[model samples]
Target: MTKKVAILGAGSWGTALAMVLEENGHDVRIWSHKAKQADEINFKHTNKFYLPAVVLADSIKATHHIEEAIKDVDVIVFVVPTKAIREVAKKVVPFLTKPMVIVHASKGLEQESHKRISEILEEEIPESKRQAVVALSGPSHAEEVALKDLTTITAASTNEDASKVVQELFMNDYFRIYTNDDIIGVELGAALKNIIAVGAGALQGLGYGDNAKAALMTRGLAEISRLGVAFGADSITFLGLSGVGDLIVTCTSTHSRNWRAGHMLGKGNSLKEVLESMGMVVEGIATTKAAYELAQEKGIEMPITAAIYEVLYNGAKVEDIIVSLMQREGKSEA
Candidate 1:
């Protein structure tokens, strides 16, 4: 059945998902904060800055007014950054007269509260107006997905029917969806893996080969699973698509802004420079702060996360971090 869907945020990922929804034959409206961007998307059917050289479907419209975009939609997809969720939700609530199923593609913990994206949505959006919230995440990249690349992702929720709803909405010939009840594990896996991706980019920037990156990625998964398990997530979720799968793609792919930012950092560029150069939100940078703080609060030993935190926040040198990681006291490989 075709449903009216509102995708909040017109970034690359948002636009890409809009394409998927349009291809699936839904009435899709995308909300952009910038009126100019919305006008461009509607008039030209292209979001050049975000998704260059790709023509958007005419069925997918863009709106500057959040209330207008969401007023009559049956489903709402939040694709904005973690930091913008609260602000966007405030505007969204007033326009929601009926209960709407909520789906989030943002993969990051809130830097200030360390809350997952789903938690932030539930906190900001009133239960009376919102239906079930599903976490849609995995290793798929916006660029690849926009190209109709064969990609698989998961929609996780405590509510089985809700997740299945999302799965059906997004699944197609090129895109596949899986369902899981491990929302905590899925969200954490998606968020925390970015930190490791940055570390992987750093390895590449330093001219380290696959062996070193493989070691970082392997141990990085261990660190992510440790934190996820501490937060009451299923341990096995880490080995699945959202966990290890996301880590590998983000770490190695040129399409990952987090990896590119980390590469710049490893090559001695300032964080400010890297961020400004990319002009996109690098979710891993903020996630590193949140995960680092969470590890400290939980008394978990996450050496890799800590090292990335130091480099990002304390201006710690990349070379020193690499040396320190290599020189850690010998311990069991498990």
Candidate 2:
């Protein structure tokens, strides 16, 4: 069954998802905050700034108006940055006149509350304005997804029906969807992996070999799983697509904004300079702060996260942080 979908972001990830829904024969409308980007997507059938090489389907409509985008839509996908999730959700609330499945594709927690994207949506969009909240995430990269690469992701929700609805909405020959009930694990894995990805990039920038990268990734998963289990997520969920899968891709690939930002930082650029050069949100920068504080608050030992946090926030040299991490008191690997 075809549905009207409103995606409230026009960046590369949002536009790439629009392509997936369009191919599935759904009526897709993308909302962009910038009028010029909206015009580019609509009139030119391309979003040069985000997806430079991919030509968006002419059937996919683009608009700068929020109300027009969500008007009578069956599904509302929030594809904005984590920092912008609350603001955008507030903007859409006044227009959510009917029950629609709320799905968010953005990854990362709210810096202040450390709440997942679905939590922010649930708080901002009242139960009357939506049916259920779902998080769609995994190792899939926007650039590769736009190229029609074989990709698989998870649609996680406390509501099984809503997850299945999203699963059916986006699944295609090249793009596959799996339903998971572990919303907490799925969301946390999706968000926390960015922190490790930054570390992986820093390793690359600092001239570290594959052995170092491998150790970082393995130990990083241990930290993520420890913190995740403490926060009520299923420990086994860390083994799934949203966990190990996401960590591998985001940490190893240049496609990750967090990894790219970390690379620049490891290469001796200031955080300010890295952010200015990326022209993108680079979620791990903010996520590192939130995760570090959360770990400390909960008494979870996340050495990798602490190292990256110190490098990004406290002006600690990466080399010194690495040495400090390596020289920590030895303990048995669980």
TM-scores of all candidate predictions against the true structure: 0.99, 0.99
Judge candidate 2 against the unseen true structure and give its global Cα lDDT, from 0 to 1: 0.94
Question: In model 2, how many backbone clashes occur?
Answer: 0
lDDT of 2 by residue, 1-334 (tens): 9999999999999999999999999999999999999999889999988889999889999999999999989999999999999999999999878878999999998987989898899999989988999999999999999999999999999999999999999999999999999999999999999999999999899999899999999999999999999999999999999999999999999999988988888899999999999998998999999999999999999999999999999999988999998999999999
lDDT of 2 at 285: 90
* Sequence-dependent TM-score of model 1: 0.99
* Residue 312 displacement in candidate 1 (angstroms): 0.9
Minimum summed lDDT over a 10-residue window in model 1 is located at 92-101
RMSD vs true structure, all candidates: 0.7, 0.7
Reference-based lDDT, each prediction: 0.93, 0.94
Error of 2 at 134 (Å): 0.4
lDDT of 1 by residue, 257-333 (tens): 98999899888899999989988899999999999999999999999999999999999999999999899999998
